[model samples]
Target: MIDRVPAQFRGVADGVVAVAAADPRFLAVIVNGSVANGQPDEWSDLDLVVVCADPYRSEVVAQGKDFAAAAGPLLVAFTGEHVGEPRLLIALYGPPVIHVDLKFMGLGDLGERVEDGLVLWQRHDSVQQQLDATSAAWPQPDAQWIEDRFWVWIHYVAAKIGRGELFEAVDGLGMIRSAALVPSIVARRTDRPTGVRRIEQLAPEMVPALARTVAMPDRADCLRALRAAVELYVEVRGDDVVQQTEAEKAVLGYLDGFPA
Candidate 1:
């Protein structure tokens, strides 16, 4: 299984596996993301799911930095609280620096996964059995959910632009790209709504339009980018999804007031 990892990452991967196997508290280590899927490239980070004994979950999480440091020269490490998963320790390692994500969890957490990771090492068949019992389901975007918030978000972006807060306006534009447009565009082909992940490969035809949504710091350019985002959203959001008509009308009118 270590051979499946890219050449650059194999050493670190093997080191981590061996470290986890030697520890009684750590139950298993599963590799997920691009590396597990056999599609790793230079930019891909090592994503490891470290399953520990239920009783040791808290202790293991607390000592996450120590555990990760055992695998390599950990440059800096921190829990992924910002991304909502405190169990995850994101670390950078090396003279030849590499990014690694170690998501510490118990065997109980295996069933609720988005993808089936390759189990690099495990104490028993319990991990495999738990994975086999349930199918992986990546989250899909809800059209209604996006629709409900889209207009309000558009208004917010417009407000930032109107107030001459170009940075805020640009950030708002990014939110639209990642939250609304990227998913809608990616969903057209993969049915999986990834937020700007390999979007060029998935939907190259839409890249130019998507590129237009990125704004410069200037006022007119920001408004232009926002308009591009709004247009792109309308184009991608399918007809079947109900539109928020009054809000859309109000927001569009407000946006039109801005001189691009």
Candidate 2:
């Protein structure tokens, strides 16, 4: 069984909520993600949102990290205001790495936005209205970007292997991220959210096929997984976008060179 969070950590969350509620500019504070989903393991971290009267009007971004940091010495890793979005802050803490993704949303407009799962811990009328307006929008992955990145990343992996950099090759073998594009495309084909991870549960058959295709016994196996990853990419994207790409040609040539 996963260890329940220490009372001190719970108090930290409560304290954060209290701080937000006391501020006139802050209308509501929502606890979301893993904790909200109730699937928290011992290493789980808090994901929260601080809904403000005006998203861009206040300095919520600057203060959020400071606030979380002040809560504990474990809050050492900070990803400052992701992707130029002032309304969000991402941080990590604890030895095992717990992530906290904090977002600031406009009070009146909060309900208009949609997130998959949100649990409101503290809310005013204005905040509740905003939360009510929230809609659920599935995130879309950039297929073209994934396609291009797959080839580039694999070639780098191949080069590392060629240079006898086994550790680097293993470290770089993040086929999961590459394999994710396939499921995203499949999900879109089935009319669901794209870019959703842990999709093996959705389609168990694909998981084994993916594993088989990407399995490698040694350096050769690494290359095999890479080739399979490329072929899988082609299968997902179709020939039109990826057919003429070098990755496609390389996989084909590799198959040709395979000994009988």
Candidate 3:
């Protein structure tokens, strides 16, 4: 599979796979994202999940630096922000400076992760069924999931606005987009809910316009973007949001209570 992608990424993949295959602490290693499901291209990062037995989970995760060293000369390493699972080491390697993400998890919990993951190595056959039946498809956001969160998120942002906290408001807006709006917009499509990353390539029809929703800390600008986000959500989702009308209206009216 490394041969399919650009030359720069192949060495990184080669090294990681070699190191992972030789590690006794791990039960299996899975390759996910583009390499797992899509055709190769120039830009791609290696997304690997290292499935460890419960006894070795913590010790293995602590060896992230060693993993990086094994991948190649480590340039820099850091823990990534929690999207959901808080178990991953993010690193960049020098000379080529390729990005590598190493997610560590126990063997039992491996089946719960829903993504298109192609198991590169499996030390034991107990979880063979798990890999063969991986949920690997990108699921569309359920309308109920959005409805439950959207109204509350509006209030969360409104509170940030009320407190005069522009930075939190900005970050809150991004969370709502990534969590609710973008996924629904590109539902049934191959697009990932990656905030505004590669918007032109992934969500061209919807996100280019949504980019205008970003705003300054000022009340009027934040409210302006907030309103735009609502309009886009409704336009894309329609009847799915009808139940949210009264709650949304309550907040829409509540926005006026803030200084503008």
Candidate 4:
């Protein structure tokens, strides 16, 4: 599997293995994301899960920069706190730049993961054993959960449009696409409802509607995109979901008051 790693990333992956192999604290260095997902290309980023002994995980994460620097010519590195993952060290490496995410986790933490990773380097077979013992499951979007919030969000965006806050209105539409429609659309093509990821490849039929959601910060354009978003959401939201009829009616009526 290591051989399948793209040429541009091979060096960094090899460097990580070489460094991790010698480190007693690190139990395993597993590669995930596009590489492990079996769809890696030249543009793919190297995502790694560096398993450290439970006692040392904090220290290892604290000094993640040092470990990343040892593995490659790290140009810039930052903890993934902004993304709500403090354990992740997002790094950029090279004269030929490549992005890598090094997530330092305790050995026990491997029990819960979104997907299986390729065991690049391990101190023993324990890593594989743990992986075999547990299943990797990505969380699916709950239709009902989206349904409850959908009308509320639509009303919020409508208000923004009415107030002539085109910038906020445009951004709100993008959020709707990502949070509601994109996942709903992607779900139709693949079991994995990855928001907007590879939408063209995964759900080509929805491309025209998806494109219509993109507005140029103009009031009329935002209103049009908002209408498109509503229609698309209704189309993709499966028959099983409960309809928020009254709320939908109120929101649509409110939005109708807006001048195109």
Candidate 5:
């Protein structure tokens, strides 16, 4: 299955390059996003960044639509340029919708401001220095911010669940985002990643037992998850800071209004 998809991607990529190469302004071509991140699932899309000498050149901008259409009868959703960077979102005529985000960057203008990107093709040594400098500046998740938001967001999740707002409740949970911080803290405490998935998988036994503190039943599982989420937040935070605050109190009051 993977072998077949790459073949299709190659065909589309080759067509894009062939059209792009016709113009001398185009300096290089890069493919980034999930595909470059080494985490492509079956649903992943081909995110291509077209690096050119002048990204805003009349010829390049004009050809953007045509370049996308070269992918055959696929439905192309063009998101235009962001801060002068052109983009396209495409879905091919296949079961798995293939998304392609195209960005045009100028050679001389490519600088330290950009994120770490792969150099699929390069015309000169200038892009090398910029790519290396940008790579060094990759954003690391802020530990203090994550720690502060954990407790505060849990109360919001509880209130959302209590109110029967499932989508908002799930978003408020932030399990995946908060989970990233836990592994780092746990690694510091246990000296290993532990390769756990959900917070419950690696939650310490010594933390306050939440079974009695949080109510649960067959119908209110989302509320259970929300309460468990709060307990996990308290566990990860430790005594580094107190969970109780004016904002948390207000959120708890809001949740209290929605009786179990």
Candidate 6:
């Protein structure tokens, strides 16, 4: 994965890592994601985690782009919409147009997020020991969590149908898919996938269902997709027949509003 990165990228990563490794504020420097796994490609994003020591943790996160600019020519930087990680700095680098993601994480917050990272540098044995003590496992989304959201999400789609917002209705399907459906599918397997980031690779079988879940603007097709999503979520996630029945009834009621 690391090998697949462009040569310029190598230099950039090296520079960034070197800068962070030397900083007293940062305790460790590690590379992970596709690059660390040795499967990087032209489109692969650079994921670098900078373990900030206690004193400078807040300062580092608040100064996201400021710190990232030290590594190279960062044209622009923004905070990523990362679901779990908050201190993420999504940066665009140039002359050559490279994308680098820098996360300023603290020791207490790292948790299971640093499992497979190849440590480029560490402050000392003490730092390594601290890293080792923290779990490398990501917590899985559980049943109650998905169940809580699934019912409301089904209603969201139904309300969209009532409003004749086919575009919004179709888009609402994705909310259910990512939040509930994908997690349900992943939980059925033995692997410890954090989320559906690699759903295509992790569960290719479900891709077609995603296509089927997208509905046409017409009422019949919208209802059909609603049914498909409900059935799939129920099938993969175990039947909450009560919720399913309620959703079915509500969708049917909405569909009846269309002229026969």
lDDT values for all models: 0.88, 0.59, 0.73, 0.87, 0.55, 0.75
In TM-score terms, which candidate is top? Answer: 1
Error of 2 at 125 (Å): 2.9
Question: Cα RMSDs of all predictions?
Answer: 1.3, 5.4, 3.2, 1.4, 6.7, 3.3
lDDT of 3 by residue, 1-260 (tens): 45444577667767776787788777877777777776545667778787878788878878877886887778887766555555788878877667878788787666667675667667888556665656444444677778866878988898897788988888888887777777667665654555445556776787655886788878778877887877787776635454677887887788667666
Give Cα distance to truth, residue 77, candidate 6, Å: 0.6
Which structure is stronger by lDDT: 2 or 3? Answer: 3
What's the distance in Å from true for residue 224, model 2? 2.0
Off by over 4 Å in 6: 1-8, 81-84, 112-114, 194-196, 216-220, 239-260
lDDT string, candidate 5, 41-146, tens digits: 6666777777666545556656666666764445655655443444333335332345566665565445633355566666676667666655333334444555
Model 4 lDDT, full chain set: 0.87
Mind giving the per-residue lDDT tens digits that candidate 2 earns over 105-201?
7665454554544445545576555455676554555565566666666667667767767666665665544444455456445444433344576
Candidate 2, poorest ten consecutive residues by summed lDDT: 1-10
With a 3 Å backbone cut-off (N, CA, C), the pairs that clash in candidate 1 are none
Per-residue C-alpha lDDT of model 1 across residues 1-260, encoded as one tens digit per residue:
77788888887888889889999988889999988878888899999999987888999999999989898888999999998999999999896899999999987887778788888889888888888898888898877788889999989988998889999999999988898888877765885556888888998999999999999988889888888889999999866788899999998988777665
Which regions in candidate 4 have their CA more than 4 angstroms from the true location? none
Worst lDDT run of 10 residues, candidate 1, spans: 185-194
Residues 26-83, model 4: lDDT tens digits: 8998989888878888778999899988899899999999999999898999999997
Higher-ranked by TM-score: 2 or 5? 2
| Candidate number that wins on lDDT, 1 or 6 | 1
At residue 225, give the lDDT of candidate 6: 85
Ranking by TM-score: 1, 4, 6, 3, 2, 5
